[model samples]
Each structure stands twice: as C-alpha cells, then as structure tokens.
Target: MAGDYVRLAAYTGIRRGHLLRLTHHDVKDGFLRLDRTSKTRTLQLVPLHPKVLSVAQRLPLGISDDGVRASWKTAREACGLEHVRWHDLRHTCASWLVQAGVSLHTVSEVLGHSSLAMTRRYAHLAPEHLADAINKLT
Candidate 1:
C-alpha cells in the first residue's frame, strides 16, 4: 500500500510534493486534477491510465512526502535498485512515453514542464523519430 504512492508518481509524472497533496477527490472522471503545483501554481489535469486509477482509487493517497521514504528504500533494496531515487520515477515516465512514440510536446504537457526544454532531456530516446523527420525532408 505504501509503495502505491511511488508507483503513482511514476505512472502520472506528478512530482513528490504534489503527489503527496493529492486526494482521492482530485482524481475524478479519468483525470487527476492538480489544484496546486510547485512550478506553475496553476491547476493542471493529467489523464490517468486505468491501471494508475485502479491503484489510486483504493488508497487514501494522503500520505506525507516522507511517509513512503522508508518503504521506497526497502522496495529499491529488494529489487537491487539502490541507485534510484523517487524523483527518478518522473524521468522513467517521460523516458517510457518518449520511447513509446509519444511526442515531446505532449510529454512536456503531461509532466507539467514549463517548457519543451525541460522535456528535451528525453529527446535522445526518440532517435527514430528524428531519422523519420530527416527522411521526410528528402
């Protein structure tokens, strides 16, 4: 149950702070509404995948930011993933999305990035897209 929050962060790309503040009520109509965010201070709605929604719907989702730290650490150790941090989940989400052919512009929006510059870090994962773009010009 404790680890669910961490997984939610990964699946949704919501930061730790905003994720901690998320309530079940915020998850309505297949979307997660972030009424407050660290970066923009504006309400942002991120579409929730059905798997993410299922796990989220069952939990209270009100755990403190530090509440899941010990569980997260334990989970990492069990998986021999001691090098990973919770924040890395966001990077994983973006990376997965980019690899799956989702556009950087859409990924940036989903991650609530202020600009495409921040999302560009995942650009390298989509070399095929670049090649396609270059081929299209010919």
Candidate 2:
C-alpha cells in the first residue's frame, strides 16, 4: 500500500527523486548519504528517525519515480486522503519535527535545505517552544 515509502517520506523529508535514487550503500549508521544529484545539489547525511529506521534499511533500490507516483495516487485515493501528494509527506515530516521540538536548524539539515530561511516555514508549528525559549530569558 506504499506505506513504507510514505513512512520514509514522513520521517526523512527526502524528496521523491532522492528516495527513488536511493541505494543500500547510501544508508548507514542511521543517516542517509544523499549525493550531489539530489534536488539540493548538495551531499547530505540526513538522520533517520528510529521509528522508521527499519523501513529505510529495507527500502528497495529499484523503485522508479513514475511507479511510486502512480502507486501513491492510488493508495491515497483508496485511503480517502485526497489532495495529498507525495511531497506532502515531506511537509508532514518537517511539521512533525518542528512540533516535536526539534530545532529548525536540525530540520533544515535533515531536509537538505541550503539555508535556515527555507526551514522557517515550519517555525509556526513550534511557536510554543519559541515562547518557552523567550520565557527562559526572564
């Protein structure tokens, strides 16, 4: 049902193309070694959430982008998740990390964003954490 792919996207925030291009050698010691061919055009070592480590560890290296997209569309429609694109899983990953109190800088690194600005969009999800940070200044 594409749950494995969905889980990886939601936990790693890796782009569809990167995920499709992933090979076993790219993952080791809980980090994904993304190459320069990725969307960011930078090499990155994104940490894998423990919860999804098994999925990523076993991820097959042969999946194609079109195959995943078609399967995802069908799976989402079947699950009544309308309007949810494959990329939305990455957004969900970022949003969840921010909500869970992970720093934007860390999330930026995991998402392979070149700068903090690209990760700022998830800042709103951590407002309470931000407020707590300000409170600690008192």
Candidate 3:
C-alpha cells in the first residue's frame, strides 16, 4: 500500500494533499481528474502513465498522510536516503518527463503549474533538447 502511494506520487506529480483526496473516480478516460488543486483550487487533469494506471485504479489508496510519512521515513532511513522528502517524488516525475524530451510547457501542464516559469527549473535536465533545437537551424 505504501509502495502504491509512492508510485502514484512519483507517476502523477500530484501533490500530497491532492493525492490523499484521490478516489477511483478521479481515474477516468486515461486521465486523473483533480477537481480541487491545493494551490489553484481549480480542475487539473494529468494523463495517467501506463505503468501507474493499474495503481491509480486502486485509489483512495487506503493510506493516510501520517501513514505515508511514517512509511517514507522508514524506507528512506533504510535506504540511507534520509535527506529525501516526499515531495521529491513529484520532482522525480517531472524530471523523468523532461529528461525524456517532453517539452517543459507540456510538463508544466502535466504538473498543473500555474506558470511556465515553474517548469523552467526542469529545463536543465534536458540540455540535449536545446542542442537538438539549435542543430535544426544548421
């Protein structure tokens, strides 16, 4: 269950609070419909990664914030990753997408960021994309 929670966080890029409120109903038509976002209080839809779709189908994930925190603490300590925070899972999702050559604009949308600037931080992860763009001009 805890592993499912971590996978959902790392796959969807959903915030902890939003993730806690997620229900099976949110997983529809290949997208996770977040009706109420913590920051914007607006709807956001994130396409479900194929690897995580099965996990998302089992939502309301049956784990509380405390449960997640406790599990994260234990797992991190056991793995000597005490410095890692739960939110880093969200970053992991974004970083993976960026490193895969997904545009930052699309990544921002996937993360439901209010502005493109918020996604720029991940641009550095895909410097090859920049090189490809410049190469196109030659």
Please provide, for model 3 over 27-125, each residue's C-alpha lDDT reduced to its tens digit, 9 standing for 90 to 100. 899999988555689888899988889988889878788998899899999999999998999999999999888999999999998899999999889
The candidates, ranked best first by lDDT, are: 3, 1, 2
Each prediction's RMSD over C-alphas, in Å, is 1.8, 2.1, 1.4
Lowest lDDT sum, 10 consecutive residues, model 3, at 34-43
Q: Residue 135 in model 3: shift from native, Å?
A: 1.7
Candidate 2 vs 3: which has more lDDT? 3
**Per-residue lDDT for 9-53 in model 1, tens only?**
888998877777677788889898887555579888998887788
> Lowest summed-lDDT stretch of 10 residues in model 2?
58-67
Model 2, 91-118: lDDT tens digits are: 9999999988999999988888888999
| Reference-based TM-score of each model | 0.89, 0.87, 0.93
| Model 1 Cα RMSD, 1 decimal | 1.8
Residue pairs with colliding backbones in model 2 are: none
Off-target runs (Cα >4 Å) in candidate 2 are 37-41
Clashes of each: 0, 0, 0
Model 3 ranges off by over 4 Å: none
